[model samples]
Target: MTLGTLTWVRALDFPELLAPSTRTAIEAWVAVDPAVADAVLVTEIDPGLADTAALTEAYALPPAASANCVLVAGRREGEERVAAAVVRATTRADVNNAVKRLLDVRKASFLPMDRAVEESGMEYGGITPLGLPGRYRVLVDARIATDDPDTGPTVIIGSGVRRSKLALPGALLARAPGVEVVDGLALG
Candidate 1:
């Protein structure tokens, strides 16, 4: 749980520290996967430093340790489909090509910030995949979900609240709710 200039505690130990949805999801996940109990950690931080670059710089964390979750949506056959694309902070989601293809739509774009926050019930900069609605397809990039030990021991992601962040092994995060591992989900 040791990271940079931050102090991390077991996420479940302080449910009040997490967004309601995040707390519920993490609790449920832990019930089924006890192994994640200790691995899931949370640390409070200034909301102003929620951005990846700012956070890493302020906390002196490794840049690669942060992962970002972005929301993308497109309409297919008049029905709308949404996805949460997770990629390392160093890269961006392939929304124009790969995501559009996966969505089976002619176009894909980042969801509007207002709509994203309203629908997700999470703050704009703090939307994590842990508690997204079931309608959202969680897509994790291969680089972040890999079993390869050298990829990194852990990853830092949002905790469904801008005031804190969640830390856990990348492999464990890949197993969250309904994640689909896509090899080219991200563009370097």
Candidate 2:
């Protein structure tokens, strides 16, 4: 299916693009919010081109239309807190300051690949906020939470696996369960 300027393959055709839990979450999301029923678009991609920089360049998508999800972990008292920070590819998430304060931890750093994969049930380079555990907080940078017509209504994000990518509206993402819009969440 082609919507506007983007071409999308049906998400159901590519099981590898979705983790089992993510598929469930997406189904539930669409079921509850019929308005965003057509918000998600899936496109086949080379696993080698999974990273935002390569994916955007190869697909002719502007950097502004690409978003990256990073998993960060911090320890406070006796518990560990982890969160997913979504930011545009051009900027970095303020993990040490904004995120740490948000998580109420002394320090926050990227979670180890092994732990992130084991816990999130997602591929290392493709861990999206869609299927994160309930305990995980999802922080969306303000730039992504606010849509811009010049960049289109959608941003390309990881599809839980490297073989495909999911293009979804920023507004839809902001409305996702557990997502919090954070201003100055990313460093300019």
Candidate 3:
């Protein structure tokens, strides 16, 4: 499948690229949302090249075309709050203040890799907001939600597996269930 100048395979073509939970989530989403189903595209990738810097360079895509999803967690008064924050790879999630305040906790920290992977049912480097548990708050940086004239309209995000990547319009991601478009979620 091709959307504009980008080439992609139907996400259904590579089920292995998605973790079980991700597959379930995508399937459920597609069933209820035809627009998203039409918008998403997936491509196979080398797990070694899955990291943002390597993937962007290897694929010849600009750095800003990539988005990274991070899992953040915090606790307050015996209650744990978790969020999935998506930001452009060119920037960093404001976990220190913005996210901490959003989560209503004193401090927010990246969830340990092992815990993140296990809880998200995704590989450490391939966590994505699309399939996160319902308990998680999906926070998307405003920069990522808007189309940058230089970066174009689409963004490369994880496919819940290190061996594949998903591409879709930024606006479409902002419409995903439970997504919160947050200004200044990312900072230089």
Candidate 4:
């Protein structure tokens, strides 16, 4: 179904109910341009948890056809801090070299799920790069932007639920505010 058809799953109004951190980030991105804000499409699905395999089957997607955006945080050798990075499902973030250089940290690592949830204010399978604290750098896999006749021009992303997903244009995601296009962001 088209994004417009997706149901808004939250119990409260979209603005009032979203986690504070998510709401704040979304609002700021919206302020960048009306189109960016308009792209958000929310929906409800079974809260059932699933790894990549289950998600792909439930969504009728091909193997390795999904894009996973992981949130990472850690400290550099000299500085005390936390940082975040986004990478696709097919590949892991180059934490050792590329990501460290990008984040300007001597070292970087994955943020545990609990911490990611706390900092993002978004439910675990629901986090999308569209709305994130501006502090983190958003990265997208160039391959995800390619057109596939079967899948249309959209890329499947979390629908704030484990059972369902939201599909939107990769180009749109690349253009969203706070998103930074990083070449070689993901490895096959």
Candidate 5:
């Protein structure tokens, strides 16, 4: 499978490439929607190049077709609310306003690295939307699924491990389990 400038293989055939929880979630999702196994592709890479910017540059991936999953959290009524914002690598998540409003919290900030990694059960640089704590809401930017010819149709995201990455149609990811597409979720 070819996505961006990298060649990937069916993630279903390479469960070892994904983290434990991520693989479980993908397997479960595939059980419900078998298409996921075929559509979601994975490829191994240098773990040091896992960061969005570094990966994009190293692999010649289109900036717009590469998505970043960021974990953000805030407290509302003493209850900690966490969310994973999936946005394009070219833009930033609107954490101050859009996210704060959506979360219904006075303020929002990036979840601490330790907490994010521990609770999500995924590596810090490889947090993907495929698997996350059930309590965490997934807020995908509206542009993620937009038919932008310039950006191509597929999007590359984390594989829950820094050594590999996953790619699939942005539209498919938007409809993933527990995902909510939100307009204005990204800031220019």
Candidate 6:
């Protein structure tokens, strides 16, 4: 379907969505970059099914064919502010150890929803890595750029909506301003 024609299969507010912080961070990222403005597609679905399998099925997507952009927040060793990274769902982001070392934070952990929303202006269930503050380090999965001829060259990501998703070219996502391509960022 055309980008404009795309509709949100589901609708939910920030309170109902558990990931307000993720949504807020994404909003900040998108505000400065217009290219990612149309990349968000909202939808409503059971909150329990936020996982990849359920998300793909709800959207009628192929099996093992979904993108999981996880948001990790932590403080680096000398840094006073929290650092954030975005990674795919197929793999897990090493927030406690490896990530902490990379970010140089004494401790690393996921940011609470309230803090995420407060720092990021976007609502819950609508978080994407498109737009965010320059201080926030956005690490993207290199696999997101792999070409899949059968499914087309696009990566499906959350559109700040629980039930809906947005499809965009992997290259486009990588090219998004402030996005960093990291290999093996996620653990399958």
Instruction: Please give the CA lDDT of all the candidate structures.
Output: 0.88, 0.83, 0.86, 0.59, 0.90, 0.57
Candidate that scores best on lDDT: 5
What lDDT would candidate 4 get against the real structure? 0.59
Q: Output the lDDT of residue 172, model 6.
A: 67
Report the C-alpha lDDT of model 5 over 67-114, residue by residue, as the tens digit: 999999999889999999999988999999999999999999999999
- Residues 1-188 of candidate 2 have per-residue lDDT tens digits of 55334579656555566877678778778788865556777887788988877777777788888889999989999799989999988789999899999999998999989998999898877888888889999999988977765677777788888887888888789889779999999998
What is the model-wide C-alpha lDDT for candidate 1?
0.88
Following a full C-alpha superposition, what root-mean-square deviation does model 6 have from the true structure? Answer: 5.6
Cα lDDT tens digits, model 6, 85-181, are: 5555555776766567666767777778776655655444545564445567777767777755555566666655454455667766777666777
Per-residue lDDT tens digits for candidate 1, residues 88-164, read: 88889999998888889999999999998988888978899999988999999988875334337688889888999
lDDT at residue 98 of model 2 (Cα atoms): 99
Give candidate 3's error at residue 158 in angstroms.
Answer: 0.6
Q: Identify the runs in model 5 with alpha carbons over 4 angstroms from their true place.
A: none
Worst 10 residues of 3 by lDDT: 1-10
lDDT value, residue 178 of candidate 1: 87
Off by over 4 Å in 4: 2-31, 63-65, 77-83, 148-152, 159-164
Which prediction has more favorable TM-score, 1 or 4?
1
RMSD score of candidate 3 (Å): 1.8
- Model 2 Cα shift for residue 169 (angstroms): 0.9
Order the candidate numbers by lDDT, best to worst. Answer: 5, 1, 3, 2, 4, 6
Clashing pairs in 2: none
* Candidate scoring better on TM-score of 2 and 3: 3
Please list the Cα RMSD from the true structure of every candidate, rounded to 1 decimal place.
Answer: 1.5, 2.0, 1.8, 4.1, 1.0, 5.6
Clash pairs, candidate 4, are 68-89
Q: Tens digit of lDDT per residue, candidate 4, span 72-178?
A: 66566665454444555556667777676777776677778898777766678767675566676676656566654455555656543344454556766677666
